[model samples]
Target: MDKEEVLNEKYDEKLDRQDVEGQLELNEEDDSPIEEVRVTVPNTDDPLMPCNTFRMWFLGLLFTAIISFVNQFFYLRQTQISIGYSVVALISLPIGHLMARILPTRQFSLFGTSFSLNPGPFSIKEHVLIGTMTACNTGTAYAVDIVILQKLFYNDEKPFIAGLLLVLTTQITGFALAGALRKFLIRPAHMIWPSTLVTASLFRSLHHSVEREDDVGRMTRMKYFLIVTFGSFVWYWFPGFMFPTLGMIAWICWINPNNLILAQLTGTNGLGIGAIALDWSAASYYVSPLVTPWFAQVNILIGFILVTYIMVPWAYYTDLWGSKKYPILSAGLYKDDGTAYNKSLILTDGIMDPQKYIDYGPMRMDSFFALTYGVGFAGLTATVVHVVLYNGREMLDRWKSARTQNEDIHSRLMRVYPEVPNWWYLSLFILSLGLSFVTCVVWGYMPWWAVLLAMGIAIFFVLPVGVVQAVTNQQPGLNIVTEYVIGYMLPGHAITNVTFKTYGYIVNVQALTFTADLKLGHYMKIPPRIMFMAQVVSTFIAGVINLSTATWLINTRPNICTKEGYPFTCRSTKTFYSASIIWGAVAPDRVFGNKDGALYSPVQWGFLVGALLPIPFWIASKKFPHITWLKYVHWPVLLAATSNMPPALPYFYTNGLFLGFVFMFLLRRYRYSWWSRYNYLTSAAMDSGVAICGLIIFFAIQSWEGEFPYWWGNPEDQDYDHCMLANANYYGEIH
Candidate 1:
């Protein structure tokens, strides 16, 4: 792709202002006042530019399909990883320009419309739209979990059509909310969706190049990205495949391999006190070290320390929730005797039998696992309180101000393109609801009222939660709250419980995801109509691919979703299925209410604890003006830090925070020039390289047994990181 001159010459900020001003109000400020937005995002907009062209759809849909399938394929594994949209950013740019160079430009009439295969150079607008489409694959279609759960665990005979519509309705339904909330979430200069800045910065790096300058050593961003990506690709082989133990270098556990206490305190499966990840996937898994602001990462670090170091250890050592019967940390459901919970014994005809439950006894979890669930409860309420205290008035004023409030520069520039009509969003919203009702009722998933109630839950919480995410990169989830509501409402229907949670939780999540994408488009100055079209089409395609991949895996792989399946251990579904047992088949009351040995009863008070957590921070910030960090104490981000610990290793946080301190903190502060020039591009490169390499390693070699030579690095008879004692329970030693 041609670098500096072509881009600099083509996208000059001429042909603007007076042309756009005749039709729309122009903001006096040409630039975004927000520094993060201003530096990363371009101030110019070329409305006459063609973005939704043939090259975009061809490449966009292609990448979307691959990402969706790969994410869904890995989601069932023990250590699941996602291929980020940054990969799309890295790979699509060159392909896009190539298509522009090679494809025929001859115009043709199709159904009273004229179109051409090639449309100018592969514009940044097209890149932005293409990235938006691939962003749809960032999430594994949430509905696919229900499909896998039913097929693998519940043994239900649901039609493929049901799962397909489930994926479509649950995912695309959010676009309606995105359309409605653009003013509050996207247009506001204050609502700096920090992650979107990375995308904006990355696109700028990919397109614009320095012909020659001593500043960045005259190296173009494309060249820098390629170097970093290639280096990351080669480095991942040791950690990812050949020497898998490098993923978790639990050096602390190596000290006292035979001691239960030391292993429990330091193992990858335990608290991971001194463990470190040499792998990029572990470091950048939950929180992107390169992208999240220093303040947010600091808050996460505090939360992680409190939960993993202090709270969890105290609970486990003190024998809280029968902690002594299990390991300090675990990713499994258990019986009272510390054996694996026999889910099959309790389930009869896909429903929990009351007599069978009594005979089988209650399910138990490790202290860290149970407490994380409580933290989940607290995080949701904390989000409500935090948003109300921190941003209530501003959000309210924006909504009330509506179009009368002065639009930001991005908003004003976007005025050149016709906005997506309200009727379009409304049509999708109404259709998704109807389809959801049909899919649930026809397939006997959840009742019609349950669907309404779930949607109601989504509507109520979406705004407050959305506000939190819009400001901070962190988003509090709805899983805990949704499960509790439906578990108590309509218990003893396992599939229905997950179904309700999926609708209530994922509907809100999809809405937020769509809103974030809208914000990204807003920053990039892509037309709202093109943004909408790209989102809908890509989402539908990704959903189909997600469901198809899961179905194929279940149909072909023997013992899929089981521990024996090793690589395809279906670890995530176990957690999903565990929720079914706790909330659906068994009922939350018996488990979390007042039954004998109901150790988790007090955990429900997290709702109250969460509601009150933000008030102290708000008052402290107001009372003690000198203490600036008090205001930055984001309770939702804090509490939700360890939410993924069962699946996410502790080293993920430690290593991520460690690297975050280096890049986001030290480098950004100490070396401002380098940080501003190449930080985000480095992130994009690292992500792209690791993702591509991981895929190659899996398909080419890791899928087959003995493909990798066993050695000290790739151990055959012990824990990968040599935390052997950490595999057993705390006391009575269930090894």
Candidate 2:
């Protein structure tokens, strides 16, 4: 029998069962296993739908340039932002439909095959390809930071070609790694990549217009999406611009304005405890409330409470690392004398002056800042431990099955498309490796062995980190660990330290991001080869645009790294530069080793502590299998949650968790029908709205020296939310 005949017979049998008289129907309360409802992948045999069309390429290049420029421009600002993928995915659909209506469908022959510039109709595949292109340019290139560091801090000007090559090499190397892991990561049905489900549902809602009678209670997804998108866009103006204080509401600080301890505990710009941030930008800064599961949110919440409310307060009150002398929450490193550490005083010819350093005294970190590193150390170890304990066997099984197994439903459907050859990925990897090696050795002034070590570190960690991100939509990046390793290996070479850290840490991040995109392609059933080509091409485009944008910003902006710059104060770059001094120039041994014997010296043991932390949870889950909650206790999530103090606002956790519980738990459990239809669409709409409005506000007003007229609504102090705790005397200095 034909496959179609078999499917039809199964469908007819299901209908016949429904038609049976006097049959008892299973209700929601029934304990029996529900019959699996299989959805046939749509348009599997439709070849006329345009995917790799000229229109796609044209629109892709246009959007990639816009998004890349916007993203790179924002990356240098105090509040680093990126264009959301949903913005691109949502915008592309209408543009694609418009092109389909106008473009001619003239066929042409290519390599003995018939093709067309406009293949009969617009396709979801083409929409996804466009999204893929936009997604590549959504984040600032990692190498851009390295180039900025060299120029701004070290005063070393790199040739444009050298910078371009460095960016291309790092970005492409990650893509190659992602491609190599396609069989293990992308070809699995269970690797749901929860985030991609939102995009997939949005695609179906847009392209598949034929609604059934079963969808009677629900509004059209597009209509609902538009309503939410517009509402969010309008709502954001008050919090995002005119009344910026709406983002952070510290009621405790408002009530007790003069109490130093209370202010430190409750202020948004202070320790950020007992605060309620209303803005989506502030609430969603750390994690997306819509996509992250309630269980994960709960775990993160518990960790935040323990760290911020308990650990941080205890250390601060006790004056650990002389916490009472400095602000409780700061990323800045200070001198032991409790004054701000000036880099210029200690630097002689772009390298640390040993005599100047000895005279200046050792650097001291804020109590909370030191604690973040300790927590980060614990998070890193816990990630490895948790993955091995919970997922090792599953990963091993998947690798073994990749050789012969064709069990996954998505994989079986995807077999129709030609696979991207392994040699293609290998060739890209080899070229990227050679180029990166040469750049680092020659321009970066690093030994050949160090470059090789960096690449090796990336390769070793990518798989484990990829597995963690694939299963849980979070990745514990190798940034801290990479710096620690390289610092010890090649001390006093700040440029080489950052260069190594970029390759070692960012390569893994880029690879996981690419793999996620590849999985999105898999879900949408785009051909593998086309996805590969689109990713590589778009990445190259992003490299050029990002470098150009960064160069322009640096050249045009004066006082780029100073206090006078305010919003353009290079906050992120300063943090990066600080890490180089602490880890590379001064050396970790001086801070955490026997020389200091400070409060943070004990933090080095967190690795050993973290390794043992997950064992109890794993054992409990196995021993008490019926206690279901025990299994959900993910140590990595718990440990990682504690490390969000410095960079992220505290209310992000408190607010996002509240929203997640309300949506994922309350709405999902009680209003199943509504939740099923609108949850993901609502998320997509909100993200798209906020992102679109942000770009308009920046480009139209802020970038052109335009500002909202100062009033109570728009404060001149930049503390319109009144979240600043006026207790500068309590902590000697306010960052």
- Which candidate has the highest lDDT of all? 1
How far residue 509's Cα lies from its native spot in candidate 2, in Å, is 0.4
Candidate 2, residues 590-651, lDDT tens digits: the string is 66665543346778887888888999989999999999999888778887885666778677
Residue 295 of model 2, lDDT score: 71
Q: TM-score of every model? A: 0.94, 0.91
Q: Count the backbone clashes (under 3 Å) in each candidate.
A: 0, 1
Between which residue pairs do clashes occur in model 2?
245-721
What is residue 298's positional error in candidate 2, in angstroms?
Answer: 2.1
Q: Which stretches of candidate 2 lie over 4 Å from their true place?
A: 1-48, 78-80, 110-113, 402-406, 556-559, 563-568, 596-599, 726-735
lDDT of model 1 at position 640? 88
- Can you write out model 1's per-residue Cα lDDT over 1-735, one digit (the tens) per residue? 465336435543333333334324535376678766765776666776779798989989999998888888888886677888777887798898788767887997889999998767678889989888989668798889999888778778689999999989999887777788887888888788888887887787777643323434557777887899899999998888889898888898898788889988898877788888888888988888988888889989999999999998899889997888987778677889898888889888888887888788887888888889888899989988888888888877877885736777778778888899999999999999999999999988888999999999998889888887877787888887889999888878889999999999999999999999899888888888989999999899899999999999989888887778787898778878888888888878777887634668888889899999999879989999899888888998998898878788788899999989999999988987778778887877888789889878776766664357779888877478888777678763763
Q: What's the lDDT for all of these models?
A: 0.83, 0.75
Position 71, candidate 2: lDDT: 83
